[model samples]
Target: MTLTALFNKSIIVSGISFLLYFSSFLSPGNATSNNARLTSKDRVTTASPAVLVFSKTNGYRHKSIEAGKAAFTKMAADKNFTVEFTEDSTQFNTENLKRFKAVVFLNTTGNVLGDQEQAAFEKFIQAGGGYVGIHSATDCEYNWEWYGKLAGAYFLNHPGPKNVLNGKFYVVDKDHPTTKGMPAEFERSDEFYSFKNINPDINVLIKIDEKSYAGGKNGDNHPMSWYHDYDGGRAFYTAMGHTDESFVEPLFLNHVYAGLQYAIGK
Candidate 1:
């Protein structure tokens, strides 16, 4: 063959060799090599962080549950988190629970989860998962002791004739992420839940000014929102979101977002 023809063949041979070597670097399970310049589309896939919102109520159901779900779903869009809403206790299983970073008991009341399901939930928390109890969530699972303390408190009574009342909230720990950006004090019209056997270890984020409203039961120390580290996990609870209008309130939405962030350790 001619010298120029031989040189051309050699060039083609070198190009093929180079491509073969490069293909090995791009092979499955080997994309992390320094030589691999994989684009995002070529990278291994992962599920986005997700939260499960449970709103099951064997007792009285909240009229605001749908509003609460809508609010969270909107917030999740902006926060880049995924949210799944379910009233079915069957979703409380080892496999399904493992997929979530946080489980929110949104206005959940009465005995929502059965014994086996509750066990699964406990294990989920103990495995470093998060829990967020909203409004009537405090009224759930009265027979489950761990759930009571994990929820920060149990629902006892509220000021009523009517359970919903107008009250002023005091931001007890503004430094807490959940209470940060919150006003030092603000008035809200919702069900101000009275809790029984509140866990003192909980870091109170906001408290209600009993003197500002009637049926003051907890004296001056009634907590409206709180968070704490519990059983290898985190727990956040807020006695807010009782009314549909409350979910639309900017402050209340922010409060719920902050609580979720805290629970998820974001």
Candidate 2:
């Protein structure tokens, strides 16, 4: 071949090799593969909504950390939310709180937070951050007056020594997104908590009929789930989701998904 022709061929070959290398770098097996160039919409979708999950206690009741984690993983796939799970109160710092759009207390109990963490959480909520409490969250931080107030109630007690039998729940707020699709009266098996000093001002979403269980603190008016605006921030709580079975329930999962969406301002 002529020298000029050979040079042109070499240039083409070099270009082809470069393209192949570049393509390989962008392939799925690469560490940065999924980190592919994101469009504006993609960036928005993948942007973390910032959620902090506090699972500081197992309480005296059955602990289901794995169950909570599984549910959270499914929720995080939404691409609009990022979740961090921790049992350490030190993780509740001002900077950490500021990073998150919402904080979730997942099946926690007892005084799991110190004064600093408690203050940081209060400031976070007052500054318009969102809060979500699941299951035994009400059983936590009993001494902190603000915690109970924000939760809209404190765990006074529970009905049914075991939480397997079907029980009736009354839907108090049919219009709320979390309880929207749920029926007026539904039966489900799960540990239902009764709260003390349940702020009547908060919007009650679901309640339990006393006749459905052996012993309940709030009688027939037991509020099992609720949502409200507290201190300029949104808050949601559910007495459901005590077991692995509860998390898999379609209706219960839908309720949780709606609550998480609302909490993240979706």
Candidate 3:
């Protein structure tokens, strides 16, 4: 063959070989392709559940809401749980809530939802969904009976005009998952809450020692955290997370983390 022709033929053979090799690599049966196969197990780490955070309230406690959001996001990223956050309670419609394994009320307060949305949320919980309430979540839905029952209490009062001091948190049920990694009694600086008509039957996980705070209501039995079963659904609530400082605390974060996981059914 001519030298020029030989060179051209050699170039064509090289090109064809390269294409064949690329095609093989791209095939699903190839080892490289198999390595990329994504599984549900691969997406989540601890078989943790999914959680949705709903914060739809307008008031002076915006900081608390923001802190709650940050905490939920952090947990969602590292744990086996997924999180969806929104300030619109209307998004709690049946279809939207069905996608989440659990729902969280992040420092929400007052009448944030309309009649239809309230009814939908009630139904959602009754259907064996999970719920997690943080901080001022107790101050929410004062007129909704179902919600009050689910939350286990309503905001009756606060000692400080605003949350500005450190308070002691007393663990009522240290054996609970939410308190499993926490100390029996720990003092932290945050806004403490007192509830009205807290359901006595609900499992109380943590309580605030009223003696530690001035002008505190509910006396010495003030509950700081609780969990209960409502209409076939699991519910958790913590009076903590009133400040940005609370979210970053290692011990507090662990408590919130376990609560979120439990509410997600993990």
TM-scores for every predicted model: 0.85, 0.81, 0.81
RMSD of 2: 6.2
Q: Per-residue lDDT for 1-266 in model 2, tens only?
A: 99999999999999999999998876777745455544555877657687888888745644576788787877787544778888888988898889888888888878899899889999999898989999888888888988888888988777555745568889988988998778899898887676787777678888988788677778667888888888879889998888888777889888987887787777
Candidate 1 lDDT, 40-113, residue by residue in tens: 54443334679999999999988999999999899889877889999999999999999999999999988989
- lDDT tens per residue, model 3, 1-266: 99999999999999999999998977878765567555544655434566788888865455757776777787777664678888886797989888777888888877888998987788888888888888888898888888888889988777656556777787888788788877778888877777897887789888888788775789867888888888878888888787788777888788877776676666
lDDT of each: 0.89, 0.82, 0.80
Among these predictions, the greatest TM-score belongs to: 1
**Rank order by lDDT, top first?**
1, 2, 3
Candidate 3: count of backbone clashes, pairs at least 3 residues apart or interchain: 1
State candidate 1's TM-score. 0.85
lDDT at 219, model 3: 80
